[model samples]
Target: MTDLPDDLTRFLAGVAPFENHPDAIAPAARAIEIRYLREGQAARPDSGTTFPEDPWSLYIVRSGAVALCDSDGRVLERRGEGELFGHPIRFGQQAAPYTVQAVEDCLLWQLSAVAVRALAERVPELEAFLSSDPGARLRRVEALRTRRERLADLGLRSPVSIGPDAPVAEAAARMAEHQVSCLPVVVDDRIVGILTDRDLRGRVVAVRLDPDSPVEAVMTTEPVCVDQELKIEAALVEMIRRGIHHMPVLADGRLAGVVSAGDLMRTQSPHPLRLVRDLARASDADAVARIARSGPALLAGLVEAGTDVTQLGRMAGLITDATTRRLIELAEAELGPAPVRYAWLAFGSQARLEQGLISDQDNGLLLDDALDADGEAWFLELAERVCNGLDAAGYVFCPGGVMAKGRWRMTRHRWRETFSGWMAEPDPKSVMHCSIFFDLRAVHGDVELAESLRRDVLEQARSSEIFRRFLAAGSVTHRPPIGVFRQFVQETGGDASKGLNLKKRGVIPIVDLARVHALEGALPEVHSEERLRAAAKAEVITERDADDLVHALRFIADIRLRHQVERLRAGEKPDHLVAPDALSGLHRRYLRSAFGIVREAQQALAQRYVL
Candidate 1:
């Protein structure tokens, strides 16, 4: 190897993987062979006749462009300056059928694979560089979030066990000694029941039960529990739904630890595991309002921590659910209990749990059909207070009066009728209502009402072919803003003229596709990703297409999340409009890719629903 020229050495240090290794420039220049590849210079190797002597070589583009074509002559990938290309180096499984050819005159470093590998071993920095695949590296930056840190990551209280045959007094003593709220009652080294302090206070002392009685007599058999591998946010949702203070944590199908509200508070409070708990205890609108204001800051923290957009959406939805539920509780406390059971329902984004940083609250109420005139009057008053409280808490009421404060949205029986009418008619407004109301979920109260409505909606859509067509029409209403030239089609005229509304033109198309497919297949999910997965599971959509749609949805959603995070950091209100000019070359490229996927998805939907 000869000593490197200064210009050649400088070029090597300028690219990524290499950008971090300035010291590698001299050694790289000395050991690597620089080939000035003129336009279409690299041999095409048609029929494998033009293959280089040692085809196992790494190529780093210093300038100009290169395109790798498959054996069929399809341009499989395009690489530019600072990008690396070489199948033999990336995937070392014999010969690859792709031809590496320069698209223009280029200065490429044809590094010997053997030497690069040896250099990588000696230099730790180069190892990271060499290990990074360019395509995967971008996708990794796009990696919004992985699964929530599992519960095992949140160090738990040591497992304390007591026999089911032990006296209630001894169980209580054990809890006292450990300062724990609950204890798993094991029999034959397996948990059969659990006794909590609440059980002792309510079932034993309150009833004046014999303290010497077997713990099994008072213990809750088969108590609600969670696995140690579950995410904290998911655990919070389950615990909140069950109205339990503590849940037994399991490992290897046996009791491993007890995770109390106190533990979640310590670990996830600032992130909403504890925020939900506080929302539950919020005694008044003022208390709820205070916590709601913190939502934006909390969201900012999540985005900064590189939380995945999907996880961020779920957290936001949980916060909204907890906030709304708290407001309902305050309303109930003030207005007195309802004459009949009623469920508070969320619609649209809230229902789908795709709520972003800013959203107008869209919700309704599902009252028990048994409500009389007085009951109706009581319910209306409650709705007024709750909706108003929510508005004050930053969930401004829907400008379309879509909030729970409406009479039309107040009854479960009428809701079914409303769906039937919409399906039967399928007018513009009715179709619009169908879009909003179809993804309904119970945010609070009698969930069975929601279940019944879900069943009815599926049945109604299944029986009505015309209704499914209308749903398809609604889905294709908005096209992704990517144009025929593989360029962004910006909003020509409107308040959003600065850029495309990433929400409407990008995210919503996939959401609408998911909604249509889910309804068509009678999938029982409200979330877009869940609906997509469920639809795929039923074979309604091929697995590859389904996966493409899912990836597109996440990537588009991540772009919006990033935009919102940027606005929040700049102390400005977050919105979905994003100017392509503001994005980097890589970002714009991915944006086009994401929007392209949505276009393909819409075409798929259109082909399926031929009206």
Candidate 2:
């Protein structure tokens, strides 16, 4: 053992395990301690080691394959030579939480916890790569997360296909059964043509071809085929450029599967509007309610799938709003007789379209104020009924008591007067109202209603310096939670105390800033992220800044969605509290980078506006 020098011992202590890539103290690995495990030897369970509470370690698989099993027999993770394990332990967890068994003669570098922390502190890139899951890293490399290329990567996989000689009826039945828009016609492992729903409707039915006619007769022969090796971005461009919904995949002149337009659409978080569209077409309120219950599922799915936070919020809002709109439609149909011209003003997320899975109803009504006192009183009654109906339909009532049911939010003239008063003085509350009301997209009735209010508010806000101050101040409320002492600020209390709430901290900061930019730059868009990008193009914000914010927002949203999905899978309510342990190594690294971007953007925004 080479004298076991003091510096060397200290370094080994730092790099004890996978979680401890960076040594905790200032020292370098003079030499790593190597141990070879012969076949049939169980590598020490990471849980077995304890010292100084450094809690960081990395088991370097230097020369053999090792399989990790949970207390249960299920495989948790696997590593071969050059791979490492034990990252889950660094987050203060003691248990290796997984058991390891040598599958072959193995050599390992026993990295100490202290050494790993030190290395992580100094080498950010190494920290990110070493901390991330190998599978996720590989996917990122192959799919390209920063842009639109991932679509093609999915589309060119093995396609659902049938033999060309098969009856058109059979192919059509398969398409309907699978809910796919098209089926590729294959002959001897080569895709010769594609039979789409459109083709069946137009060529088969319109032409009165027999249902049992050969699919080849109705198929779009020699359909555009994308090479499996082609970049996803290029495939997307080609698919869009060609105006084709279904593209056949070919690998080495052999048929791979088919990719549909739906396949081309990069898998996105559960979009509220998509859900609303589904709800609108539904047969009854029970179905609408059932779909509405899926809000948490949608939120979690987006987070799990890695959808950007800002986009996820927007999509979330769209679904919530859509549900509200449908519920309102159903309620109104039952109630009958408008009795007056009015705007069903949706406040909060319905107004902003950036709702979370768990949010309450914040709505108001704006009437023309032309009704008599008795009529007006009756209108308030109607408003309460509508709000209550929406609540029964699944939207909980706002705890803060912001709803059309509240008489303060029911008057039409009061709404206009309220904005006017706010414009006249522009105090903190007034500014807050502006921020919330500014997002109102007007879910139902009188399209011109919300627009009139918006135009007046914009005109007032564009000129009022006080309003800008209030807006800027409100926008700066949520700071990115990245710690100054370290890359990320792990929560330190409660169940979610250690895990970052990406929504409130990371996503909201950028969203609010983007909203401020939109208002100040007089951008027409209401969604904060969208407004930011538009403002950038209009020179209100630099394009680079906008891109960074968008990218960071998207990445964080993806994290939030994934976390939510994991919770859903566990049969827990989808929430912002994601266990740091649940994250793949790559995600944690991306989160760190995402936090950095958010911090930089926030600093810049502060310098430009609040500071």
Q: State in Å the error of residue 162, model 1.
A: 2.7
lDDT of each: 0.76, 0.65
lDDT of 1 by residue, 1-611 (tens): 58677777777666545555566666766777777877877643344532233534567787898876665666655677766666332322123556777789988777787867666765554432333233333344344235457779988868998998899999999889998889998877677888998899999999999999999999999888788998776676566556677888889888889888777667643666667777888878999999987887787777676666776787788788889988888888878877898888888988888888888878888888887899988888888888998889999989888877775455777888888898888888888888888888998888988899889899888788888888888888799886543457788776868887899998888888888888878888989989888988998887666776777778778888889989988999899999987775446655665676677677767777764
- TM-score for each of the candidates: 0.80, 0.58
Please identify model 2 stretches exceeding 4 Å from their true place. 1-278, 281-287, 298-315, 374-378, 407-412, 490-498
Best by TM-score: 1
Q: Which has the greatest lDDT? A: 1
lDDT of 2 at 535: 91
